[model samples]
Target: MSVSKLLSRIVAHSSDRIDTCKCVASSLHDHTYGITSDPLTQFACILSALIHDADHVGVPNTQLVKEETETAKRYKGKSVAEQNSVVLSWEMLLRPEYCDLRGAIAATDAEWTRLKQLVVNSVMATDIMDKDLKGLRNVRWEKAFSEQDPSEDAHVTTNRKATIVIEHLIQASDVAHTMQHWHVYRKWNQRLFEEMYKAYKEGRSEKDPSEFWYKGETGFFDFYIIPLAKKLKDCGVFGVASDEYLTYAIQNRREWEERGEAVVDEMIEKVKAVWEEEAETTDTFVDEASVSL
Candidate 1:
């Protein structure tokens, strides 16, 4: 299959978000970043977007690390999942039989280095559930913007910095829902919450979900996502669309909250059930191990 066709098939599982990403990529290429006009770069960006979270199991990196000790030890807490994805995705491009889209992406010395960095960082950032990773990203962004020499050519500087920043941009884009229309915002927020809650519940067997994990569809607008979107808008790098999206996010949170306590109760129950099941499994395992000894 052609790269675009492959992307379209993978996107069917995440049609709305992927379609939104395409629109964002086009707008960014034409109106915002201007770099996406390069077919190779555009392909890199789209491929990164399409594969960043492919087959995401809704599990957080930290949880994966704690549970899959061998995998964690192998990578020493590095991006085990993303690294696997990048290698697997690139290898897919190398099969001699799949030459249909070969060389459509540049494999030149400089271009390979740049595109690979972009793809790796973007995929790694999807582990938003890692507070350490998020903090590191914040620090890195602050350093990049603060350290860049504005008088020099941005392209002339080390591409590593530029690539990392673009990765941040893509991550911010994936999270751009907070800055969307209220109707659109609520739908995505719910999906994200469900995904996170699933992870949170799964982690309970090991430890309490980090205090940040929300147990209910409570006042998320007043408490979190809305304010977060506003903060991103205030950052100024994300442009005006992000600001508009944040406004709608606040509106969506309000509407969802108005749906009453029943919805919140249901969500909490679901999350709680996962925790309960995980605990039972852990206990049973412990009993088995003790008896074996």
Candidate 2:
């Protein structure tokens, strides 16, 4: 699909999957950062979201690396998925069919280069596998928010602010489902668990995926999701949305604490049923193809 169309679909899907309150909260956050008014920054963020998982393989980078997949070898285990998504998306844009569209969007050579770099950097920033990126963001946050004078030389630079804001915007949106209503979060969480479980069953992952599913999710909320919402608030750009997300995340975590094991068991049953149905369908298709051949 064209980039614009893909982005539109993503927004629509998110609206359907996530609660309206959550969407409104995120919009308020964007408004606080003035993202809606800045065309270039806005475009970069939109592009990042559109291509963040353009051709995801339903597996994590850790699994790909463990299996020595071509992608892992190509990327040398560094942000494999993120880099692949950028490359694939860029390849689509560079195709002959997209020449006119590309030309219209990027009028000058420098503009095109800048646009490509922004998209790459923004997408790459989403790779949580890069430990240093989070550290840098934390350092920047402390300098910008913890100081008496944010304008001091030790604080975040204007360019750094632009980069980090865009990065955080895409990152937050990528996992927005986690901080939404319980139903919404539950649906996507199950899907992710199923994906990881598939990898584990295939012997690609290092650990028993099902064993720690509930505990891992709880820990994820405690260390990552909750902290992320707070960080957005701490940055002073998305306090309203951040607050809404933090509240929901806390509630969701509690709900999980009480019922997570049952939920995980239910999800496992659901995933098993779905997988069996899919296997049957695939087998039928293969038999039909063989007969025709």
* Best prediction by TM-score: 2
lDDT of 1 by residue, 17-42 (tens): 43486776665443323443456554
Report residue 84 deviation for candidate 2 (angstroms): 0.5
TM-score of each: 0.61, 0.79
lDDT of 2 by residue, 83-175 (tens): 999999999989999989987787888887888888988888788767877787678666545645645553235455556666766777778
Model 2 ranges off by over 4 Å: 1-37, 147-156, 275-293
Candidate 1: clashing pairs of residues? 179-245, 179-246, 180-245
Alpha carbon lDDT of each predicted model: 0.58, 0.74
Question: TM-score of predicted model 2?
Answer: 0.79
